[model samples]
Target: MARLGIVALLAAFGLILTATSSPAASTLRAAAAEKNIVIGTAVATGPLAGETAYRTTVAREFNSLTAENAMKWDTVEPSPNSFNWSGGDAVVNFAAANGQRVYGHTLVWHSQAPSWVQNLSAADLLPAMRNHITKVMQHYSTVDS
Candidate 1:
């Protein structure tokens, strides 16, 4: 019994020491709608017609709010052949405008990439990497509008 209490205290202490940011969206707001088992919709999305009405409620029975997914590095800059920002850019823009925080899914990962990326020569790889970073960051940096 005493050991269990000590473990719990240690866990709580670790949590306090870790840097934290604004709470997750789930904690800030309730799901826009309720849900059940089959289907659901985000609170952000209007209309609870069909399964969304039920599923969403169930999913949120214990939580609030939904999160937006903003990931598309490979699709955005596939193959080092071209750059595409439509997916991620639109997300960042929307979040910024709506006063929502946008969490980048990842800046770097060991897997999940287009075929061309894996075959790139060092010469081709280096410049492609730099260019992609510069463009993606630049696009978000000017989100003042």
Candidate 2:
């Protein structure tokens, strides 16, 4: 109840601020009100091969899905020539077919990286990272971000 009250107060303050704010205040207010209603689904379970059965199962349950830990730089682009879009593509396609939305996991983050990526020189690293983003975004950008 207290949390709800605080949220309500914050929302009221946001409205007041909008009224006194710049000319783009209405656009900002509407944007703020537009919810990023993302439904998250983890690819931790089911078949070890790829996002086959599990992907469909997740899509069946939720309207929109933000695949958890399914998308990462390394797996998307392991070596210079290797790129794996199967898992991530599955989730995105699933979301699209089901009239849902998708969220790309990340652009820059550690932990889920390939060994080759870890050993990259800064010069090489930049292009490689950019490639990963392009590939993933190309796969998922069909649904207007």
Candidate 3:
């Protein structure tokens, strides 16, 4: 299914490339700007930040960016009390630098959940989930500020 999506995207991009005079004239962001809807891509922070080709394509082709897995429960909160912001922060910082809007992939999910969450009783799940969300949002408050 994912491979089909990629193939379809490649086919669409090929059409766009053939229709335009140059690569710069065929940006998804530019087409989306005409329609007033944002065009975005899920990107890995490391490649988006460190690889020139990936960074350049993302900045030029899309107006918004989403972290592929950096914002997932397991990646952000691996243990009970500890939270890691580095991965998520890197994506946000890169998006800001490229003049792209940051889209949070998800706040919580059953998949990729930490062991602590999996062990929790049904009664305690809600509070723990709320706390996790609050902390994540608070950590990124300055983005909106």
**What does the lDDT come to for candidate 3?**
0.77
Per-residue lDDT of model 3, residues 1-145, tens digit only: 3224434665697687787774444567777786887777777766756778777777787888777889888899898768998998998888888888887857888788888888799899888889888998888764432
Report the C-alpha lDDT of model 1 over 1-145, residue by residue, as the tens digit: 3224334544553474454664422411232222222221122211222345433332333222222223445666675647766556554544444444444444434464556778779898777777766776676664322
- Against the hidden reference, what TM-scores do the models get? 0.47, 0.57, 0.81
Model 2 clashing-pair count: 0
Q: What is candidate 2's TM-score against the reference? A: 0.57
- In the range 17-95, model 2's lDDT, one tens digit per residue, is 6777554333222334345444343443223235455444444434445545566766677777587777777666666
Is candidate 2 or 3 superior in lDDT?
3
How do these models rank on lDDT, best leading?
A: 3, 2, 1
Ten consecutive residues with minimal summed lDDT in candidate 2? 24-33
Ranking by TM-score: 3, 2, 1
Lowest summed lDDT over 10 consecutive residues: which window, candidate 3? 1-10
- In model 1, the runs with Cα more than 4 Å from the true position are 1-70, 142-145
Top candidate on TM-score is 3
- Candidate 1 clash figure, as a count: 11
